[model samples]
Target: MRQTWRWFGPKDLTSIDDITQAGAEGVVSALHHVPNGVVWTKEEIAKRHSEISTRKDGSASGLTWDVVESLPVTEDMKKQKGDWREHIANYKISMRNLADSGIETICYNFMPVLDWTRTDLRWQVAHGGSCMRFDIADFAAFDIHILKRPGAPADFTNAIADEAGRRFEAMSEDDKKQLARNVTMGLPGSTESMSLEDVQAHLNEYGAISRDQLRQHFIHFLEEVVPTAEDLGLRLCCHPDDPPFALLGLPRIMSTAEDYKYILDAVDSPANGMTFCTGSLGARPDNDLPAIVEQFAEKIHFLHLRNVKRDNDDIMGSFYEAEHLGGDTDMVAVIAAVIKEERRRKAAGRKDWQIPMRPDHGQDILDDLGRRAQPGYPTIGRMKGLAELRGVFTALEHGAFGLK
Candidate 1:
């Protein structure tokens, strides 16, 4: 795997020096300044690339902006409501501009309501700082109590509702605000935040669209976009739905392996691929991580490797900063599967054999708390994660080559 670090462009507090120091060879970023539904011009892409390339040696040696963490889909695109054809056309133009500049891998998600939900952005880790995580109870608390969207209580049982109510009532004002920010504030790589009115308006657009409707819309999107991607030699990797479940009255389409199969089957093109995110899929215990990797080995273009600790029954737990080998994911087996796929690609003489992989989310530690870095993208924590993954990959490669 070719290791990459996600840099949120020039506005990010963590400079290119910080990324290089973290031992990443490539940068995953997007033109965050550009609004959703607008075409990203070639000049905009070049400007951002040149800005990042301005390092101490007047060159970004190990840094190449090869992956876009996201090019957000407007609400119109998701709902397939009004002017979406125009939006999709603009998105295709952006992909073409990005590809013209040598970006081959593009990662995007089609989740309806939220991109990724976290009850706490500063959820404290026992040893030091914090990492982002979704607490089911906390989310329930928000749905049924804080935001208090109608019909929210029905989503949970009486016992769960009661617990959520209690948690909501007991929370301090600051805590409530934090939870709101955690949920409503769109993270970097995604678009801007929405007012309550904006969210309600967005929901109104999707009122007629069920999960099936959304799925059809996504399939239609792929049908239109994938051919353009293929022409540009860009692999369009769709990120799995985070939390892998429906929430806040929105539909989730890409939650399971079957969902992925449906997507590829809809487009039936190599350009339509998956960005295999372990933490996202691992949230649902039913998903056998290794099995999915082995099954979809041919279509996986990118990976976000992280682990989550799921408790028994319905009780969910915090995300631990587990070592690459220590997490719930059978990473050794996962790596072995990836290696098998790489070997297969090599035998076929494919150029993009070494997939670009990143340590997904990291625990916020050390000086990261005070720093102005993007949320959940702390410098030291990700540096540690990248280092650990690299060590694991090295050992696996050596073992494959029979190196003592």
Candidate 2:
């Protein structure tokens, strides 16, 4: 496994020096300042490469931008609407520029409107630490009472609806407004910032689109872009939906393992791959983490190894981010499966044997309580996760899992 860290940009509170201190071998970042539909010029790509390799005093940092966390697939491209063809052309050009600049992995997603929805940004855990949480009742309150979507009532059970009603009544005016902002945080550097009214308008537009339609749209997208990626020697990894379930009546086609197999089969190319995110897929109890890892190990190009403790028995359960080894996921088993896959790849003499992974999210503990870094990208929190995961890899390779 190749250890990497997700860095926002030059303006990020956590600097490249900080990533170096964490012992990460590479940096995962994007040209966040550029708009969604715009083409990333070779000059722009080279400038970011220069920044990652050089320091403030113009000396060498020895770190390279190995993977792009995303290359921002816009709404028009997903829906095949206004300027969709033009956007596809631009996306291919960006892939060529990135390949020419020596970056191989690019991660993206097909989620509409929101990137990741969380009802509470700071939900206190049993310990003194706080983690990002998604509460079903609070989300229901926002959907039914706050956002007032057309069919919000039919999605959840009667019990969930009743609880949501009570929660909304208990919340003060300030709490409701803040809850609205938290859910719409979207991508880190999205070109368009939306409001509550804008969210409703977007949902209204998707009323006619079903889950099957969305899946077809995504396949249509890959049909155009995957060939370009294969030609450019780039591996395009699609990130799973954050919660891996339907929310606010939007279709979530890329949530389950079956969804991944369907898309990979549709594009049937070496360039098309999956970003195996344990945190999102683990939010559902039915998703067996280790089994899923081995089942699609060949297609997984990037990894996001974080755990979440689910609250309810159903698919739409509430979940909160947990410490690296403290969560319900069997971290040791998951890492063992990853190791087994790498050994298999090495025996086959594949060039891309070592997979790139980063600690996804962490609890706000100790010094990270008041940090200026992005929420979930805290320096101390992620360093702790990286150390814990590295220990897992070390132990497994040294006979802990009998690999030695």
RMSD of each: 2.1, 1.5
lDDT, candidate 2, 83-177, per-residue tens = 88998899999999999999999999999888888887777788787888899999999999988887898999999999999999999999999
Candidate 1: tens digits of C-alpha lDDT, residues 38-115:
999999999878876668567755578878989888778988878899999999999999998989999999987667
TM-scores for every candidate against the unseen true structure: 0.94, 0.97
Model 1 regions lying over 4 Å from their true place? 187-192, 313-325, 399-404
Candidate 2 off by > 4 Å: 190-193, 399-404
lDDT agreement with native, every candidate: 0.80, 0.87
Best candidate (score: lDDT): 2
Instruction: Give the Å shift of residue 403 in candidate 2.
Output: 1.6
**Lowest summed lDDT window (length 10), candidate 2:** 185-194
| Model 2 CA lDDT for position 395 | 79
| Candidate 2 clashing pairs, residues 3+ apart or interchain | none
Question: How far off is residue 156 in model 2, in Å?
Answer: 1.0
